[model samples]
Target chain A: MKREDLQLLQKREWCKGCGICVAFCPTKVLIIDTDDKVTIANEDACIKCRQCEQRCPDYAIFLEEASDV
Target chain B: MRSSQLVEKYFRTKNLPHIWCPGCSLGIATRSLVVAIDELGLDKNKTVIVSGIGCSSRAVGYLDFNTIHTTHGRALAFATGVKLANPELHVIVISGDGDASAIGGNHLIHAARRNIDLTLLIFNNNIYGMTGGQFSPTTPHAALGTTAPFGVVEQPFDLVKLAEGAGATYVARGTAFHVNPLVKYYKNAIEHKGFSMVETICICPTYYGRQNKSGTAVQMMHWLKDSFVLNTAYDKMPEEKRQGKHVYGEFVKKDLPEYVEEYVGIIERLKGEEDA
Candidate 1:
């Protein structure tokens, strides 16, 4: 997702596409693509709840605080 | 070379690409422990990780803390000594079902009975992963393992009940799919003053999964999502409806005088009497 707003730092290599983050997201911000990799579907709809960051099994998702530049 | 900032800080990045097979839930379990420690803001210098010989015990090498990789079934003994020698240290034990319940079961019970100040995180994968998929003490009845090709006939030990019966001040259970809840349990366990035990229902995708046909790692994760029921929710359901459901929740939490604290008190009092 875009860093100007609420950004998510993802180390995709660690990701096993467990789909826990995609399902746990409130705003439906992520999706497991056809290749079984997570993709940001709606960046602006993201609420930065940190649910995904907390629940991901592989520690693939990292939520960065929104920086006002 | 570390890509993740959190990993760089807490884990040995040089040990990147851990030995655990892909889709193994151990990483998630270890992550919860790290997250709990971070949330608690525990001083790394004063923290110690004691582990036994098993796949779950591999966490000691990657964790950036005072760690002891002890022999089979001896992690609890080593951790007890480490805690008694330095009461200031936060001793954490991470072990598998076989290492903790099968071989080290006595140490576990006595430690909890003593109400020692230590957090024991038992990774209950059901089967012994590193030991060629033998049925462990926590393995579900009739579950398939290498040693039990026709399925296990013996019943599994309920860890939460055992810990509570043995006098642990804090006891909780959580699954790998419920990482947030696992982190909360771990955080609470770490903060607990007396002996604390958190049984993590982890997924062993390599040996157990392949042998039992439990599905791929992702599917196993989804199975956990579908199966786990919190104790609160279970209480709300009808008794018959709760059958076959694995309940995960904080079963007990009480403030008890920790063994370490009490032992130190006795030492000071005896020393004073001798001086007098």
Candidate 2:
């Protein structure tokens, strides 16, 4: 799936700011925000590979097929 | 398609925000198993999750399925009874490095030797995380643990090698960083009809990390990515260079008759002979 066609969902409370997702994300789409939680720093660059989802030990982040709001 | 949906569909919602320490890779490994089970379209009622004592053993309580939370180091024994009684259940045993390789070492080998139809997932964090960071059978030599203040002197178990040597029909190794491949191995292990095991290298920041002076959770994850070589590439590395490195991949997959099947065959033959 294309990055533009995906929505990144972050459960901020569950994130411990472990950057395994960032290390695996080929697109550099994620960053540990000031709060020590994962954030989509580059939404447009996301490749929708779901590496973040797969690597998240917290079950804190995921990708969903974008739904019309 | 939604994160909440994944959680609600596959997990027992009330039991989560699981008590696992933040950055513990047990959650990551558990999710891979969940994904494998979901993708396989297995019947939840017929699937059983069995676990023995340890941090990883707590997974049975969280996963939404028929689960057996057995005593320390005896999960395989309990699971064996469960599988033999029903023979139709998909039994999966989740155990810690200490629980599976130390106290339960005998059961682990015998189950594999018998070629039982079960998926034995070893959540190997090297140290005994739940028990105040004691050194486990899989702890790397010289790694610090609460019990090994002077640095561990004994050799560690090569878990995949042990499983293979014990006659497991399918054996694989995966680290927490390699999530997708880990999930694939979980799926294949579950599908295999004989004794199958996947040793998942996990990060225990609260124990192994602190004792070893390993960096933060993120850094530990990077270490996991670095410390293991794929089985294919490991073959070419010289013997000296291969020391302290793990080889991750499926070591074996064979079409072998499972324990339950052989037992049932004997039962059927006995019945026929009695009639004659």
Candidate 3:
């Protein structure tokens, strides 16, 4: 993903590629991109379980309200 | 509340990226703590967080509160002093397994015995991650560690049992994988009037996982999920089914007179007598 697309997701810089969020995502909605950081490969596949939000060590990825857009 | 919101509210944003290794459970465990504090609507000014040296102790630096990073294994001792000196402050001691049970073991039992109004949260990763993987007191029997290259022969200390035996008013156990219940345990522990200890079983992915072949951080979390059952459900399981499995829940909760209250009463009584 390019810099601007990456900036759209909140706290994306904090992700350390621990893989906890990507590994635990039930829908396989996330993937570690070539940059070794998490990028949403399939946003539509996200179930919004928030398990990733709960277990992320870096607080890097979380669900933002659609209204914030 | 949103994790981002909790981060903005409770953490020192300047230290946004923590020093902890990637995939460490300390972040998850630490998140539960802030969540508990937020859920309770505790006054940030009145809450004091004290910690001893370890990965868990590093949390104090990132949190936005009155925090103390004390000497090794002296977290509870320092917390006791904080509670006694202020009496109005809500003192919370954050310690690792080695910091709490190994080095500061004496202080732990004594604080529990005194029944002080301090909350001790033990982030038990089973091994000493900060020192490059030495065997800690909570390392499970036969677990691999640098010191126990041949495997640990001695039985590990059950922190819940130790706290309960030492007369703590509240004692509970939770794991990082079980974040929701862990937050509840933390909340209840803080609200308890007397000394309370909540042990959160965390993961040391770099050291413990690699040494024990426990797989990646995600796999270790799954291990926690599969190995530990809730206390209520654990009791109903058959003996064969319970083997190798640990239980997590509030093992003990009872009312007890707090140490500060008793000490204050003594001072008040003596002052009244002198006036007469």
Candidate 4:
């Protein structure tokens, strides 16, 4: 059975690479790539609280819920 | 912390021990607002406190009045709607600098221009405290933030001036250190007939103060007490003496047709036509 929480990923092109989401996430689920685009490196640890989604300056990342998986 | 006090009565027992760090001025500002509300003897049932997302936005959660903690930077817009729907309701918007003047700047100006009957308590701690110490519109030039480690190149918005220019009927400024004056100004704003604003300068010791080497909360409070000159007293001081200091006091106050009242008039006129 898939875990109830889903791993989230980002669309690199959409990310201006602002690190606001990275700073805001209490769970530390997001990381900035070398190109300044944010990447969801650890999806399993994500609480899916949408802090990144709400704070992302570029709207680059989208959370895929566990139910979708 | 009198139980009979309006501010004390609305204290959230469940959220006891607030998350704000030591020396944060938001708690002081919140208490001043509540005290002002209580002193005015405003009907609790007709009071609505609205807020946008930020560390200070947590004020809505703690207040016992009708509260709506809306999306980031949208508290003014939401407060405008609440006041319009029920003209008798006393609506107040409480938010941080970023929430009020950065992303939510348009709403702030428009609300003032419309002369909406609402009180806006802008907690200007300079940096964006909630999402880390990021530079906000109110961040002083050369101040360090997570985004501007090298130093901020941009000039900060003077919110009281902006509100006064936008046509707010009553405009004033106060700091966390001056609690009694702050509360008194807040009460005046609440009683004012049109859009009234009180820009409360708060300390963010965890972020802005620490990064800027401004010392602890007490030190910041001392700085605020030292920095401001009351307008009533300032007018009597020499112009050269006032150059580097910020003057705080009521800046502008004049009655104008409120947005909701005009809107109601339009609705009534339209309804009359329909009946005719």
Task: Please give, for residues B1-276, the per-residue lDDT of candidate 3 as tens digits.
Answer: 223667888999788789999889999999889989999999999999999999999999999999999999999999998999999999999999999999999999999999999999999999999999989999988999999999998899999999999999999999999989999999999999999999999999998999999998889988998999999999999999999898999999999888999999999999999999
RMSD, one per candidate, in order: 3.0, 2.1, 4.0, 15.1
Per residue, candidate 1 scores C-alpha lDDT tens digits across A1-69 of 554455776767766776767876889999988877778888788887877776665667777643411
Better of 1 and 2 by TM-score: 2
lDDT (tens digit, per residue) of candidate 2 on B160-273: 889889999999999988888898999999999999999999999888898899988878988888878999999999999888787888899988788999999999999999
Each model's TM-score for chain A is 0.80, 0.82, 0.79, 0.76
Q: Candidate 2: which pairs clash? A: none
lDDT of 1 by residue, B1-276 (tens): 124556667887677557776677888899889989988999999999999989999989989999999998889999999999999999999998999998999999999999999999998888898877989988888999888999999999999999999999999999987888899999999999999999999888878889888987767877787788999998999989877778899999998888999999999999999999
DockQ preference between candidates 1 and 3, better one: 3
Clash pairs, candidate 3, are none
Q: lDDT for every model?
A: 0.86, 0.89, 0.91, 0.80
Fraction of true contacts retained by every candidate, in order, equals 0.29, 0.51, 0.73, 0.00
- From the highest lDDT down, the ranking of the candidates is 3, 2, 1, 4
State which candidate has the highest lDDT.
3
Query: What 10-residue stretch in candidate 1 chain B is worst by lDDT?
Result: B1-10
lDDT of 4 by residue, A1-69 (tens): 243544465545545554656765768877878876677777667887755653332334555543432
Query: What docking grade applies to model 1?
Result: acceptable
Give the distance in Å from residue A9's predicted Cα in candidate 3 to where it truly belongs: 4.8
**Candidate 2 lDDT for residue B251:** 92
Q: Give the residue spans of candidate 4 off by over 4 A.
A: A1-69, B1-7, B271-276
- Which parts of model 3 have CA positions greater than 4 angstroms off? A1-9, A66-69, B1-3
State the C-alpha RMSD over the true interface residues for candidate 2, after superposing those residues. Answer: 3.0
